[model samples]
Structures are given as C-alpha cells and as structure tokens.
Target: MEFNLTWILLGLPVAFVLGWLASRWDLRQVRADNRQAPKAYFKGLNFLLNEQQDKAIDAFIEAVQNDPDTSELHFALGNLFRRRGEYNRAVRVHEHLLSRGDLSRSDRDRAQHALAHDFLKAGLLDRAEDALRRLEGTAFEAEARLALLAIYERSRDWGQAAAIAGKMQQAGQGDFSTRLAHYLCEDAQTRMAQGQFDAARKLLEQALATAPQAPRPLLELAQLQQRCAQPAQALDTLENLARQAPASLPLAATLLVDVAQATGQQARVQGLLETQYRQAPSLDLLQALVALDQHIGVPDAPGRARLVQHLDHEPSLVAAAQWLQGETLAEEQYHPAVQKALDHAAKPLTRYRCAACGFEARQHFWHCPGCQSWDSYPARRVEEL
Candidate 1:
C-alpha cells in the first residue's frame, strides 16, 4: 500500500509538470504567431510607404495568411488590389471578408461598400446596384443612395431617379427640387414623344411648382403648350419665364415670336424683346426682335438697321454678318462668297458654351453632354459670353 501511494504522488507531480510544459509551448506558439502577423503587417506598410506596390502586396498576402481573421488586413489587401485594377482579386477578398462569421457590423458594412464599388468599377452595374441596395439602413446608406442616384441618372430612368431624389430631399441631404424638376421635365419630354400631351402638360406644371426658378421646365412647358396649339397659354408661360429668368429668354426667343403672332400680342411681345435686348444684347435676342419687326409691319431697312446698331455695342461677327446680309455691297458679285465665309466664321461663335467645361455646342443644353452637369451652359452665346 505504501509503495502504491508513493507511485501515485510521483505520477501527480510528473503529470502537472507535463501539463505546465504543454501550456508554455502553446503560449509560445501563439506569441510567435502574433509576432509574425505584426511583423508581416509592418513590412507591408513599409513597402506601401515606399511606393513599392508589388512588394507591399506580397507582404500583405503574408500578413493575411498569418492572421486570416484580421478584418483590417483583409480590407487593406482588397483596397490595394482594387487600386491596382485587380478587380477580380479585390472582389474575392471583399467577398471572403463578408462571408466571415467573426466580422463586426461596421466591418461588414465597409466590406459591402467596397464590393459594390468594385462591381461599379468593373462595369457590372447590375451587381453594383444590388450590392448598394443591400446597404440601406446601414451607415453607408447615404453614400449608397447617392451612387444609386448616379446609376439611375446614367440609365435615363427618370421615374426611379425622381423617387430617389425625392427620398434624398426628404432626408435633407440637399435641395433636390431642381433635380426633381429636371426629372419631371424629362418625363414630360418622353410623354410628349408618346403623344400624351395632357399628361406632359400636367407633369410640366408639377415640375414648375416643384422648382419655380428652374428654367428648363418653364421652357419645355411653353413648347408643349405651343405644340398642342394652346398658343395663348404658351405665350403667357414664356412671358412668365421672361419675367422670372430674363437671362434664359434668348433660348425661347424664336418661340416667343411665334407665340406672339399666334396670340395677337405683337406689341406687347415686341416691347418685351426690345427691353430685354437693351438689357442684354444677345444675338438670339436680336434675332427675336428682327422676326417680331418683320411680322409687325416694320420696314426691312429699319429691321436691318437694328443689327447695324448692335454691331456698335458688341463686336459680334454674327451681328456684322447679319447686317451685311441686307446691306447693298459695292462688289455685288463677290458678296455671296464673302457672306458665306462670314457666316461660316460666325457659326462657331454663335454656339452655346458650357460654363463648367468650356464645351461648345450649336444647341444649348440644360445638362452638359461633356461633363454631365446641369445648367452648365450659360444663357449667352460664346460671342456674347
């Protein structure tokens, strides 16, 4: 019995010692693993700081392998891949992170956003939209919504764009009234094309109510009214536009003449044109005056004289060309060639210039074709501007 008790006591000490040694070995292994992860991470950071992207990626891969659970390392590697245009790899890393069970809420949201951006950059708009839509009610909601807005705009989905803009407006992101008005105007244009004039008119009216100061809806509404043979209403709409946004009157100047002739408001229209022309001698406004004078019984000599008078105020080749068209040239045989050259030279100057990008187009655009900015084209022509 004594011998058995002695063996038991010795076995207890030996077992405890073995357990202690095993624990120590495990602790050492864990420490080594932890140290290796940080070392690899630092090495990657050093490579990144030195702008050695290739080496940085290698080191980051090592770090990720060492500590696969590190969400931050995964995020960094994904972002690096995306920056290098390795969208496939970036997408994989971000998707893997998203699949991790241990990822925090914020980290998951971040990974989701990154993945969406990857898809967007990859031109997988459908996938990107789906990813972004999933981000609603998260911290990335605002950014996701903005991206969705851009997507809808690019696709020309006016109804969806308007709904998103409405939500953004309600959320107080910024004043989306003007943007909303544009969507309505776009919808109205489509309706007009589909032969739905009353619907178009109603939409335009709503647009005007949404943003009274916006010029596009008013201009489009006037055009719709004229197209439906509601010339008086069209004239009244344009008159309001002249009162509210005098600068944009030049855009509708030719239309103004037609509406005036149709509605028998020639005197009132002529006065408005002359007053506006005096305030701003745009070539377009001058053209409106010329048309109105011709329609009202003003003599051709006086009508041509108006262009000559404008030439003194602005050094406009366009005006000079117009004045020459009616003048009696001494070399009448060569007048055609000279006038043609002058008209050709004045054509580019008459184009509208984008205020944001300096892109010139023959037709004025509410939204710039070059930069996709709204209201980028000023009311004046390149020569006047």
Candidate 2:
C-alpha cells in the first residue's frame, strides 16, 4: 500500500507537468494563429494602400481562408472583387458570408447589401432586386428602397416606381410630389394610348391635385383636351399653366400656339407668350411668338425684324440662324455654303442637353434618358443655356 501511494504521488506531479505543457502548447498555437491573422491583414492593407487591388484581394482571401470566422476579411475580399468588376466572385464571397451562422444581424445586412451590389454590377437585375428586397425592415431599408426605385425606373414599371416613391416619401426621405405627378401623367398617357380617355383624364386630374404647381399635368390635360376636339378647354388649361408654372411655359409654348390658333384667340395667346418671354426669354417662347404672328398674317418683314430683336437680346446662334434663313446673304454665291456651315454648327447647339449628365438630344426631355433623372433638362436649348 505504501509503495502504491508513493507511485501515485510521483504520477500526480508528472501529470501536472504534462497538463501544463499541453496548455502552453495550445496557447502558443492560438497566439500564433492570432498573430498570423493580423500579419495577413496588414499585408492586404499594405497592398490596398499601394492600389494593388489584385494582390490585396489575394492576401485578404488568404486571411479569410485561415480565419474563416473573420467577417471583416470576407467583406474586404468581396469588396475588392466588386471593385475589380469580378461581380460573380464578389457575389460568391458575400453569399458565403451570408450563409455563415456566426454572422451578426448587422453583418448579415451588410453582406446582403454587398451581394445585391454585386448582382447589380453584373447586370443580374432580378437577382439584385430579390436581394435588395430582403434588406427592407433592416437599417439598409432606405438604401435598398432607393436602389429598387432606380431599378423599377429602368424597367419602366411606373406603378412600382410610384409605390416605392410613396414609401420613401412616407419615410420622410424627401418630397416626391413632382415625381408622383409625373408617374400619374405617364400612366395617363398609356391609358390614352389604349383609348381609355376618361381614365386618362382622371389620372391627369389626380396628378394636378397631387402637385398643384406642376406644369406637366396641366400641359397633358390640355393635350388631351385638344385630342378630344375641346380647343377652348385646351386653351384655358394652357392659360392656367402660364399662370401657375410660368418658368416651364417654354415646354408648352407650341401647344399654346396650336390651341390659340384653333380657338382664334391669337391676340390673347400672343400677349401670354410675350409676357413669359419678357420674364424668361427662351428660344422656344420666341419661336412660338413668331409662329403666332405668322399665323395671324403678320408681314414677313415684321417676322424677320422680330428674329433680329431676339438675336440682339439673347445673342443666340439659333436666332441668328433663323434670321439668316430669310435674309439674302451679301455674298450670294457663297450663301448656301455659309448657311450650311452655320446650320451644322448650330445643330449641336440647338440640342437640349441634360443638366445632370450632359447628354444632348434633338428634343427636350422632362426626364433624362441617359441619367434617368426627373426634370434634369432645362427647357432652354443648349445655345440659349
């Protein structure tokens, strides 16, 4: 029994020493792994600071492989892939992060946003839309909704766009009255095309009610009135537009001329356009004035003189071109060549340019086709602007 007791005492110390050694070995392994993680992370950061994104991505991937629990490393790699336009790989990385159970709620939301961005960059709009929709109710809700708004606009789903805009407006994002009115007007146009005139009129009326000062609805209503052969009503609507949205009168100037000529209200129409022109002189408004006078049998000399007066005020290439169209050039032989050159030069200047993206178009746009911004184009032509 004594011998057994002596052996037990000796074995206890040996076991204690062995346990301490095992713990030290484990601690060393953990410390080494922790140290390696930071080292790899710093290496990636160094590459990133040098703008070597490819190498940075490689290092970050290595870091993620070693420390699979590190969500930050995964995020970095995913973002790197996205920046490099490797959307598929970025999507894979973010999707893998989302699949991990260890990710926190915020991290999950971030991963979801990243994944959506990847899908968007890859032109996988359907996938992006699905991913973005999942972000609703989270902190990413506003951002997601904004992206969805843009997506809906791109798809020309005016109904969905209006719904999203309504939500954003409710959330105090910004005033979307004008945007909503535009959507209603677009729907009204579609309904009119489908021969649903009453429905179209109702929608346009709703648009005007939504934004009292908005010119588009009144202009559209006037157009609808003209279409239905209600020339007097169209003229009244345009006159109201001139009072309510004077700055946008140029957009509806041609319509005003048509309605006035139809109703034989040339004198009243000329006064309205002239008043607008005096306030905000635009080439369109001037042209409308010239047309009105010509329609009422004004002499050719007076019309030519009006063009000269506009050129003096605005110094516009377009006005000068118009004036020259009727004038006999001093060098009659070279007149055709000079006129052709002037027309060529004025052609670009005559285009309406988007204020947001500088995309020039032959016709004015309420919404820019290139940038997809509402009311991005100024009513004035490029030369006037």
Candidate 3:
C-alpha cells in the first residue's frame, strides 16, 4: 500500500483525543470511589468522636466493605472491634489482613501485633503468648516481651519472667536488674515454702549477685539464713546490706534486731543502727535501735530518750507515741486509755505504702499488688514518707 501523509496526520490527532477521553473517565471513576470510601470513614470518625462506638463500628464496617483492600481501614476497624470487646471479630479482621500475600512487611507486623493484643484482651493467655512470641525479631519485640513478662508474672511463672526480663535488659529496653532480682526472690520464696532451703538460698544469692544495689535480695537472704538456723550468716548479710544499701536499712531493721539478738551481737548492731539513724532518721530504725538497746541492758529511760530525739529531728507522730508508751504520766489512772488512743492513732503511720498505687500494707512489698509494679514500695514507713 502507498503511504498517505494526510491520513496519517489525521489519525494521530483522533487517537490522541480518544486516549485523553479514556483517561478522564478512569480518573473520574477513581475519584468517585475515593470519595465514597472517605464519606463512610468520616461518618465513622464523627460517631467515634461522639462516643457512640456501636454506630462508629457500623460505619467503619461499611467503609471496610467499600474499600476491602485498604490496610489502614482494616487496622482501624480491627482496633475499634477490640476496643468494643469484640475480640472474635477483631481477630478475624487481623487474620484476614495477615492472610493477604500483598501486605507489606510493616503492615504484616502491625497486623500480628494487633492480633496479639486481641488475644490478650480476651484473656486467652496461652493464645496471646503464642502470638506475642511470633513477634520476636520484629520492631514490636520489646513490647511483645513486656507483655509476655506480664503474662508470666500473672501465672506466677518466675523463671519465665526472669528470662523475659533478662532479654529486655540485653535489648537495652531499660535497666531490668532490680526486676530480675525480684523474680529470683519470688522463686526463692516458693522454694522455701517447699522446704527446698538450699535451692532458695542459691536463688537469693544469685539475686544478690544480679543486683547488688537492690535491697530485696539482701533482706530475703538474711531471712532465709535466719530460717536455716544460721543467724551468724544472717547477721553478715544484714551488715553487708547496711554497708552497700544503707538507705534500705529501715526495711531490714526488725530483721537486724532479731539477727543481732540471735548471734549475741546486739552491741555492734546498736552502733551501726545509731550511725544509720544519724544519717537518715526513720521510725523503723528508731524502733530497731530501742529494741537493740533494751537487749543490751540499756534502761527504759535511755531507750525512750531516743524516740524523743527522733521527734526533735522529724516531728513524727509515731515517735511521740513510742515516747509516751514509756513515760509515767501524772494521771496514772487515765494512762492506760490515753496510751491506747495514742497507739491506735500511730498504727497507720507504721504501715508501708506503695509509691506507685497508694496501697498501704502492714509490711513492705517488693511488688505492688495494686499496680503490679516491682520495687514500688519505699523502704521507709508511711510516717517517714
């Protein structure tokens, strides 16, 4: 066929015009679809802002159905379901996302994390543990490990908790030495209850080695030694505690007094407690000092004098009550009732309070029952605080 320049020129413009029209049609269709998806999404957002979760869920479901391939929508819908306590639906949505081969690596990790959260909120601990463990080398590793630690702690699996804590420490998540020591202490307590004294002692020693600055291990070790009829060893442990962690001496005060009496070292312990009291006065230390003095043949007058001295330093009601208990009041007939009232008023001051959750207990707790925080209770009593 012979080439026709005129026809060729005409055909080029016609093809161009058709191509432009087709492109415009596709663009308009895409805009319409985008607009429809956002309209439902905005409606969901409005419902969520109004605190109408049910309506928000319905709107989000409609949006997800309209845009099934949208990863963001799937994530939003799954989070809403989980928040509404609809774990099964949330699991299905995240599982559907995970099942897609087209999902990016980051989105896949995100979906896995969401699924783990769903299982955790549903109280399916075993399922949650498995799901979290799969996230081990991902960006969510630290968070997953923390969740696993909590699960292990809730189950009273101290060994698993220690393992997770050790991993977190190695990852530079935070200094978990104190937490690890607490886990060891918990395990040792269980061992002690089972009459496994040797195992308990070894665990406590390991805890001391793990966190030398942490007072719990030292205190627990001293108690364990005393229980094992090794008061001399217990006294040595408390002396090391006084030297290394003097700030924690108040918490170990009663134990110190008991050990000192048991080992016939009351005079030496009395001097140590007096020195600690001079540096940082605490009601517990004062009580320990008085007990020690009384054991070493000190008169009631001098022992009561220590409480008066404490009052001069810290205006403590607990100290005043202790002082009055030994005083000979002029109205001897009313002394008993007056002393009873003072003791009752000072009782709460002697209790230990959790720093994290304001939980008051008669004894110090390494782990707070109210907030599940480790080492949350300060060494001092409520009065000292």
Candidate 4:
C-alpha cells in the first residue's frame, strides 16, 4: 500500500493540464456570450445613427435579451423606448432597473427620473408628479421642479406654480421674481373674478412688492382700483407705473385716459402722455393724448388734427387711416370703400405679438400661449415692433 512517487508526480501534471483546459473553455464561452451582446449593441447604435428607429429598437431589444443584467443596456433601451413614444415599454425597463438590488444610488435616481419622464410623456400627470416629487434632493431635483412648475402652470394652479417658482428662486436656479409676480397677478385675477376685491388687491400688492419693476402687477392693481371705484388710487398707481417703467406707457395709456376722466386729472395726464410721447412716440400714447384733448376740448387741435400731426412725425399707415375716417373725401362714395380697406389693413397691426413665438393677439399676454414663455410679448403693438 506504499505510495509510488512517480505515479503521484505524473497525476499532478495531468490534473494541472485538465484544470488549464477547463479554464480556457470557460473563457471562450464567456467571450462568445459577450460577443453576441456587443454585436447587438453595436448594430443598435448603427441603426440609430442611420435614423432607422424601428430597426434600432429591435436591435436594442436583442441586446437587452442577450445581456439581461447589463444596467447600461437597460438604460439605453429605456431611453430609446421613451424617444419612440412607447411610454409603457420605457416605464417597464426603468421599473425593472429599479427592481434590481445591485443598482447604485445614482443609477437608481437615474432610473427614477426615466420612469417619471415615461409617465409624463404618457400624460399620466398624477403619477408623473409623484415620481418627480421623489427626485427632490437628487441630481434631477432642479429639472423635476421646473417640470412641476410647467404642470402647475398648465393646470392654472397658480399657488403651486408660485411655490415651485419660489423654490427655484431661492435655489438661485434663475431669476423667478418676474415669474412669481406673474403668478400672484394671475391669482389676483381669479380672486377678482370671484368678487374678492380686497383679496385680489392684497395679492396684486404682494405681486408689486415681489417685483417692483414689473409692469403687469402695477397695471393690474390700477385696473382693480378703477374697478373698485377708487379712481384716485388707480391714477396714483398708474403714475407710479409710468415712473417705474416709462417704456411700458402704451400698456397703461388707455387706463390712464379712463382714470384721468374719472378723477378729473385730464390736464395732468395730458402732461404725462405728452412727456412720454416726446421720449418714445407710440400710436397708443398719441391716441391717449388725442382722447384726453377731445375730453377736455383742447383749443389747439381736434383728435383728427392730432392724428395728422402723428402722421407728420411718424408717417404711420395707422395714423393716416384714423385721420382719413373723419375727413370728408371729395368722392364720398369711394370714401366708404377706402375706409373699409384701410380698416382691414390696420386690424392686424393693432395686435400684440409675442417676441418668443410670434403669436399675435388683439390683447397682450404676459405668458405666451404658443411657446409657454413668460414676458415674451412686448408692451407695444405688432406695428410698433
């Protein structure tokens, strides 16, 4: 039963050889599996680059199947699905990623973000909001807050919008004071509609305090004052607006005329309008001045005469059209047709246009309906722009 040294040595080498061969075989199998995943991934990338989205999606799906545990592949597939507007599939991929216990904190946040976007794209706002709320204190917090802000704005939930905007402002994400003011003004309008005059006035005052230089709050507050039959207060508010933002006079010019007539401050408002017109000649200012003159019965000129003077100063088609309306033409029959044509041409010119999206409306908008941008529309009319 004594052990043979020669046999023992020979068995040792044989065992070593077998183990080496086994390791090499396992390595080749691993390489073969990796090769399939990589090939599919590359094919997906190629298809994507070629703008063949359907083929790209198929290739990515194949890649994901080959490498089921690969986090990067899962992320890629989810993003691709989202891009293709397949929110359900995208949500499934991201949810699967979240279910994996091996995922890092950052990767989990990323998956969560992807899932939120999936919900958002699918128009599941309630779920999307919940998902987005979870991203707070994560890297995507700022983005999520902005998304929530947009949702609030779309829903006309001014209070929620204001809250988000305030957070963003406090975070130094960007200047949201003007946006905050707009939110307050919007809420004030709602209150005014509800016959909560005092509440609306307080909100507008808060808006003015929130952004003193913003023109909307001042103008809105004055309008509310005029509605409350506090014409003197409204006139004072408008005068403050003029002093603060002289360039925004056109927006307040009509309001000023109304307040002036109400408060018997036509002479004072005429001085302000004349001063503003001297600084920047706007059709609105000219019109306001002419109206004031007509109200006070200025001995210098009639409204038509003032329009003519504006024509001399600016050579405006709008001015000419206004002046022509009151004048008696030599061919009275042709006057109606000429006036009709002029009115038609001048109609579009009176509209306010958004600087951001070129959305034209008869009334000016603080927020652009087309592009959802705030302060996009200028105070001046389309013709002035």
Off by over 4 Å in 2: 1-23
Model 1 lDDT tens row, 1-385: 3457878888999999999999999999999999999999999999999999889999999999999989999989998899899999999999999998988999999999999999998888899999999999999999999999988888889888888888888899999999899989988989999999999989999999999999889899999989989999898888899888999999999999999989999998888889888887888889888888899988898789888888878888998898888877888999999999999999899899899898899998887878778888998889987
Question: What TM-score fits each model?
Answer: 0.88, 0.93, 0.87, 0.91
Clashes of 4: 0
Q: How far is candidate 1 from the true structure (C-alpha RMSD, Å)?
A: 3.4
lDDT of 3 at 135: 98
lDDT of each: 0.91, 0.91, 0.91, 0.91
Candidates ranked by TM-score: 2, 4, 1, 3
Q: Residue 369 in model 1: shift from native, Å?
A: 2.8
For model 4, where is the 10-residue window of minimal lDDT? 297-306
- RMSD of candidates 1 onward, in order: 3.4, 2.4, 5.5, 3.4
| Global CA lDDT computed for model 3 | 0.91
Tens-place lDDT per residue, model 3, 1-385, is 9888999999999999999999999999999988999999999999999999999999989998889999998998999999989999999999999999999999999999999999999999999999999999999999999999999998989989988988898889999998888888999999999999999989998998898898889889999999889999988888899888999899888888988989898888888899998899888899899888888888888888888888777998888877887778898999899989989999999899998889999988887888898878888989888
lDDT of 4 at 352: 93
**Clashes per candidate, residues 3 or more apart or on different chains:** 0, 0, 0, 0
Local distance difference test, candidate 1:
0.91
Candidate 4, which segments miss by more than 4 Å at Cα? 1-27, 299-301
Winning model by TM-score: 2
lDDT of 2 by residue, 90-119 (tens): 988998998998889999999999999999
C-alpha lDDT of residue 235 in model 2: 89
